[model samples]
Target: MHRLAPLVFPAAGTRHTATVIFAHGLGDSGHGWAAFVENWRRRQRLDEVKFVLPHAPEIPITVNMGYKMPGWYDIAALGLSAGQLRENEDEAGLLESREYFQKLVQQEIDSGISADRIVLGGYSQGGAVALFTGLTSLVKLAGIVGMSTYLPLSLKLESTYIPKPASANVNAQTPIIMCHGTADPVLPYQLASMSRDHLVKLGYPVEWKEYAGMPHTVLPEELDDVEDFLRKVLPPSADGKTEL
Candidate 1:
């Protein structure tokens, strides 16, 4: 499959021992979230951790009257009300994106970063992909983050979704943080909460956070919590070891 090279932020510290790959939402590119890494660096946090921001492929979005945009997959429709997002999902597109993300993770592993030191995350449509990919990943990851998003192809997770061995659910115990806003109009808050509930029911340790009156956008407090979460999951290597 064809893919665009992701925007990479090299570790500011002397060595790179860990990595965080974050994806952007629909209509946005990797550049959209580059400031996230800058914010951490400004505070002298995660200086040894490299950040990979992957741009989603530009495709026609059905809900936007078929206009092409940077999206992980095609969204059939979206509404303020809950319960409609589960239908008409693009399964093939989702699987393709999952494969792309999995390859990115493998590249990190091949470069000497342990799978346990890599965290996968994303926002909105991208978040949905991260959640799906992390859950089905064969290699155990350090953590997973989903901001203002929900899980897709949720109904078929058990039967036809996950590949063999991965069906073993290697990252079942991996930490997962999901953040959402109560006033989100694109993907309703209820949808996100339901996705959280389903994952929890499936034995995943998912920490749910909600911001009152906030919309589809992120908030300062939300990023603060996410930063704190990253600190906990991808802390400095206890042995002070460096991959490169």
Candidate 2:
């Protein structure tokens, strides 16, 4: 499979501390989240944190009128039935994306950043992929952010390729920040709650936020919330301070 081009934002200053890799939603590319990060870099002066945005390969969404969009998996229908969504869930695609994420993580690790300094996040379908990859991957990360997405019900968390005790402990130690607009039309707010419930039930610590009256797209306030979450999860370097 062809790898999608990744939009990389290298840490401005000399010492790199953390890397945040973002995945875009259906019909979107890595550029979708660039504006937010650009604004954040300016406001927070995040000169030591590297940011990466990887585009998903364009594939036909079997359910969206055969619309060929950037997606990791296909949705058989716009109106998702619990069973169909669970059954038709693309396990292979999920694994493939996980491998791709692992490659990115390894690249960062090879570049001198530790595994614990990495963060993964995304929106909508991208959010789903982030959660899936973050939870299943063997390496422990600093955090995982999911915006307007739900947990993948297809694979049992226990059946993940990574070992259980270590993976569970790592996930528990790694903070998960999930933000959802109350009025989100694409992925309902309830789904976000459902995801939280599921993760919590599985003994994972999660920080969830619900924005009032916001639409499917992210708002400025939400972006601020994300920054705050990132700060809390992936703190600054050991000099006792961070720029952003």
Candidate 3:
């Protein structure tokens, strides 16, 4: 398997206290979201958090008339409605992405960052991959942030993996942050809501938020929400506060 190179952002301090691997959406590369994180770091002041943005391999997408583009996996088709007869789910591509994603997480672990201090996040299709990988991860992660995306390969995953039921301390170890727009046309707002409901049923501790009349993209408000999520999931500072 070919390993994708990443755009690495080192922590500002002498040592990194946490590591975050955030993937990009279809047709996008690591450079796309680099600005978002730079803005986020500037606003949130998380100098102790190292960021990694991995470039998705360019592949022919069957749904887009087989045109090649940078994507976590090949999109078979778009699912605007849950009742659609055909869902373009690239199972093989999803599995391939999962393997690469695990390797990225492993690299962080080998670099001295504990599994619990590592976060996996993505937007759109990338978010779907992150959601799939994080849930099935052997090494528990600090958290997962998914925006404008839904759970991918849910049916196949259900057939293969049975998640643990949420107990007394459901999200005590690993939590989730999911946000979507109600007016999204590409992925559909209702579709994201359905995904959120499904995750809850599967015993995932998800903090789901909805934006009214928003489209299929991230907004300033959404970034603010993610910033708050980072503070909660990332490790605390020396003064016992999650300041950054």
Candidate 4:
């Protein structure tokens, strides 16, 4: 299994009830999301939530001129060819990435947070991984937050990997939030809609949000929405009224 170096952020308070595993976009490390948590701490004064960011191993993206960068998969082309951009499916790297992610989750569980109290989220390619891991895992988590990412080919609703809605082992009812920018050039906004439709068909409760006139990047309002969703899905306190 591939090893990942993760940055962990423990809640400022004495007790932590929730954990947010943050994954970064393509070519970015887990440290990329550090600023978001820093800002969150200052603004909300939330000290009871833990954050973990894991870095993806360096890999080559065929579509990006075979440049070696931090990528979850290799895209062979810039155009929309079906199999051209999906060379990562046959590679062992993605499976390794999944194992690395699983280890990260286990590390969190070892730290005292229950698996049910964990929320997984990410941006772009990282978001795709988070969604893939959250849904396919046997463990049911608190929620999943996918920002500017499309569902992975492995879990493509049209493929043979259809998830059983009535299965007692799967968390078919897990809440998922997908946020996309209408003008995102990297991953088209339509993919987000398709993902939402697919999840709904699979009986997963998903919240889809499109930011009009936004680009292929995270906006302040988008982060706010993520924060709010996290708070609602993973309440920091038992009373559920804790600010931030």
Q: Model 4, stretches more than 4 Å misplaced?
A: 1-4, 79-91, 154-165, 239-244
Put down candidate 2 lDDT per residue, 132-234, tens digits, no spaces: 8888767789899998788875347656443566535566667898998888777777767877887887777898888899878888887888888888777
User: Which one wins on lDDT?
Assistant: 1
Name the candidate that leads on TM-score: 1
TM-score per model over all chains: 0.95, 0.91, 0.89, 0.87
Candidate 1: give the clashing pairs: none
Better of 3 and 4 by lDDT: 3
Candidate 4 lDDT for residue 194:
75
The lDDT for every candidate, in the order shown, is: 0.89, 0.80, 0.81, 0.75
- Per-residue lDDT of model 1, residues 1-244, tens digit only: 4457999998878889899999999999999998877998788788778999999888889988999878899988877344566668888899999999999999999988999999999999999999999988889999999999998888888666554665577787999999999999988888899899989997889999999999999899999999989989999887757645
Model 3 lDDT per residue over 132-157, tens place: 88887778789999999988767765
Better of 2 and 4 by lDDT: 2
Total clashing pairs for each candidate = 0, 1, 1, 3
Off by over 4 Å in 3: 1-3, 83-86, 162-173, 237-244
